[model samples]
Target: MENKLNDQKISSTIETEVLVVGAGNAGMMAAAAAAEKGAQVMIIEKEDSINLLRLGLAGVGTNAQKRAGMTIDKYELVEYLAAFAQHNVDEGLIYHWANNSAEAVNWVEDNILKPHGAHLRAEPDSLVTSSAYQGFSTENDPTIDDETFVSYGTWFQEKIAALGVNLSFKMALVKIIKEGNVAVAAIVKNISSGELIKINVSKGIILCTGGYSANEELLKKWNPLALKKNVYNDSPRNNGAGIVSALDIGAIKDEEPAECIFDRGLVPVGKKTEEMYVQTATYEDWLWLGSHPLLKVNLRGERFANESVPYQFTVNAASKQPGYLYAMIWDDNFDEYAKQFHTLGCARVGFPGYMANAKKLREDTQRYVDKGLVVQADSIEELAEKLQLPAENLKKTVLRNNELVKMNIDKDFGKEAYRLTPINKKPYYGCILGGRILCTSDGLRVNKKMEVLDANYEPIHNLYAAGNDSGGFFFGSYPDRVPGLAASHAQTFGRLAGQSAAK
Candidate 1:
């Protein structure tokens, strides 16, 4: 493969069998898989290091699941995921993840994690056999402390390096140079030196450049609703470089607006949701109790939707409210009520089937209290006053909610009986909540083989994409009911793309 540079000021030219953009979880896995196949691979990243957040890696029929005495029907799981996306997603891609994810996860365990004195474990109490949405199990998480999750990424980085994968940091992808329809080279900018480097690839180029959560321009164009309804809480470096570069060369992408929105963005009292943006340092700022099925009211102090639903559903309900914000009201017995709520996903800390971080949850809530993000008062009226909501409406709403709790049946909204905890306890707490943009779910369309496709649904030669940069697996909204589905999809398709590209 050859391409003309066309009088461009190129500082250096390099050649490789496979070129991978982004050194995230997906990119690292791609580089490692290609190098393991004896292909010279170069992985580049704009940031200095990989993201250390330990995302839940969900997979079915893995060694960890077998050790936990768990079994899941892959067909049922795929169907459930398809329905979850309203059948707008590609079933082929979902089935691909369901079938190959186990092997990919086991490969990680054997080659990367276990070698570093770490292993994968199922979340306690994560398996759910009977439910409308069945086959729910804890994602395979590394057996490491939540604080030291960075070690997992570091270990994998070292393993890939030992496999002869070239890793470059501070290298930003500018565009893909294509000869007719085949991607042959990529022009990248050195972040530190402002130098352009062209890398010619003979085999393939894999893009795993994450999502456009931080790119305000892209959000305005593709997913403006997310911008208007949620606070930006993702990495600033993830600005849709890979998706844009691929689109520049006529790659097909999801036309619908989709995102991984969570209902935990804390809007301080008297502040609007639109005023809050780009809260990346949000560890201590997290409101774990916000996920609880507490009595939520709009700025007008009226209960809107059933609080027992998924996180994004709450955000969607709130988006219709006055300021795209809602207030979560809880009593002193929040700890007891939270346990009964049985929230899933990252919010399920201190509970079985997730991390045992009850202590951290308490500390985070206290920090929010200290910062006045969460207002505390002795009565509902006082709490309403502090939150700047109508006191009478809040008191009436609280009284109605307490009545529903006593009846063990939600008259207005069909909240579960167990989740109908009363808010009559003294020392009430409240916080205005909004949506938090976790990641943009829409991106370049790819097939089951992870090959980037053209507008006509044909494969773009020598081009592949994984992670948030690749789509056809998500639409409508993210299926948070299935924990770690996003990360597992990234790892699974990432490895597949690397192996396919190497060949």
Candidate 2:
């Protein structure tokens, strides 16, 4: 890591001690931490707000300060977190976050989001209600940030701004300046005006530019077995500018790829009903985590994986499907069972519809049928006819499934014995679940100091990476019941990257 005074002459240039790309949760945290440390922090973002992530109340953020009593997280609990993060996480970063994530939450509470009457209640019986919020239990995985703070990421961003850090929106990073293997500056582009901007960082360039989940081509590159791109609406331009820029500068990424949380329900993107996505993925994990023993199937209606497997595996399998869609047909009995298992906050109903909702929920699934997507009918023959599938094959498949269910075998699919049921519903609803892949878990390898690594295992000097951009922990599916794994990692690595860059 070479350290020298670098002043590259450009037509328009801005200097800063720490330059953070992609002002999402992690990047915002990085900017705030660096700025609070008295670094001239400049954050470059692509969205009007921090829209690259889905931030809700879930995680030990700065808000916990007001909590009269907050339980201290134990090392055993962090061990579960490590397991949930699939153990590729930096122990130092995890220690930083595990010790101070609640502190960050407390800071947010004291400085940012004033409490809006949100309370952290005990997670109910997951057997009855499928919730992966298992705290400190090795039986569960924790990817979801099930904290009690109201919009932690947004509030934290606001706090960063309050710290007098320079915040620029609609500014996307296009390049990273490597002065003979040492990062020094970055090239940015204003999306509105097509103006190329150069940002010269005298201190360092901390690439917090997020992950490449929104990039289908990058997704394919990361995980060749990945089927198709399937993330619910995020900034579609999140084509991994940070990771790609690093790659262009010869950053050899970590080998074990972590799969992004794939959301593949045909639904409207975010709160916008005006737009409809035919194939997407969001919160589909809840379905797999539910008590419904329904075996998933490809567009060909064949049994896929054990329902209890990690949602990422199911997501990966779905991506590998040729049609990139599946029909999850279950009986009305298991349907009723799942209905009885809704969480505490939400009313005991499966979504606003059955299990999940898409853009055209409760609409006739015939269009899906026309596209060889889904089929619904009273009799198996009618279902086959309507779906243009082999009627005899469909009947045999159902019969075999029923026989396996009766015998508790599941020899073909290896489905979990619990909650097993045969699909014998008359008015079967055939919804299309497209197998859209998020960026695979493969990320830019980084060290404990959050420095990007080369193939020779040397940390690239003056360059730091955070968030999904720094991979190597996730190999396959994320664990269950232990939410907060991703968000904590984001906070942990982001802050670590900032600290490293500031130093």
Candidate 3:
């Protein structure tokens, strides 16, 4: 392991008009778009294969645009995100995405993504969206890669390669080459052969390398109050080197924690969210969606938000909890309900991506009691004692829930209207659903023009950022919907970065 600025043993140098640092959806789109503009493009990916990560992709609102046989204009998508995130993002870069959204998303779906198999876009359960706003449906939308945000990354790479764009894999970026506040190129390492590689860019280096939720040290440094537990469904390649490089070059991070990533999580979460973890009571993430299919909640127990609306908190219900990973208590009937939901698409199935089989789902949840992944008791008082919640509060909560079950409305948690249900069975299940983080919402701060900004909010020239690289772009929180948010930014800001670099 020779670690030095220059290692004479290794030799590799390549130059291109534009060098894209990542091959995720945004990186791919940026590379493809740049290549289309007749720039010589090189895409750098650390993964041995493109799109080999556990990203969760849920394409909702855009399907309507596809159904009408019209590309959803970039502006409309921008409108969706801005309003959804309470206008917390960068307008200029988002507006640029508004222009590129349709073209980029449409192209990825129509051309590259493989469909029809275990990985196809199945219709949402009628129960899930029954109470949702009419605007949420994305009909006739093609099934995507079913990974996380980079679902479209693989397709984008193939198209770029076809156009003769050079793609380098297993390359880890250590830092950027800057001079006079301008980044001219990057210093990289060939992770496999112990080689140092330099990639020079004549146009500019587009860093789609992603955010820093993977780095516990960085997370604690940026936002000390937020938790540092990781329950990733992705690979280690996205360790946030791009952001670190930006920071070393005078990038400032907004104070918000990365959105949708884990504060802590349960091993059974793999049943719903796809990322598994060992059972632990300390694994707590607020407002995360899980794979339990049906969540069991009580007085002290109430569903935090609409389970049906995956990423809906941003669309029609923005005021709710940010992550939504609270606990749900259930009994035998609920189990039957989940079973029935599987038989047909009647109930809101939890893991549209990584659903645990019914038996496994039951077992994973059951082990939590002994392992403390969940609190259990034969009686309500015992359950409350086990949960460490206020006993009176717990009892009253269950009573109130039983009473409310008749009304079929949860005034407290805004549970979607449905048949009244009660959790009154013995051997009750009390599983703590922890939130899982996605990308860091807080990144090296940048201005609205997609320029990487300094601590004083001044632009760093010959330097630009897009995708998850733009921290202040989203409000201090990560929204429920992952795809459309970054997809919009990556395409729009990425394009803007490319065009600005070319200029």
Top lDDT prediction, candidate number: 1
Off by over 4 Å in 3: 1-12, 52-80, 83-86, 114-135, 138-141, 144-157, 228-235, 252-255, 262-264, 267-326, 335-378, 381-393, 409-416, 445-461, 481-483, 495-503
| Residue 252, candidate 1: C-alpha displacement in angstroms | 1.2
Give the distance in Å from residue 81's predicted Cα in candidate 3 to where it truly belongs.
3.7
| Top of the candidates by TM-score | 1
TM-score for each predicted model, relative to the true structure: 0.95, 0.74, 0.72
TM-score of candidate 3 relative to the true fold: 0.72
> lDDT by residue for model 3 over 376-409, one digit each (tens)?
6688777666654456766776787776667877
- Model 1 Cα displacement at 142 (Å)? 0.9
Measured by C-alpha RMSD in angstroms, how accurate is candidate 3?
Answer: 6.9
Candidate 2 vs. true structure, TM-score? 0.74
The lDDT of each candidate is 0.82, 0.57, 0.55
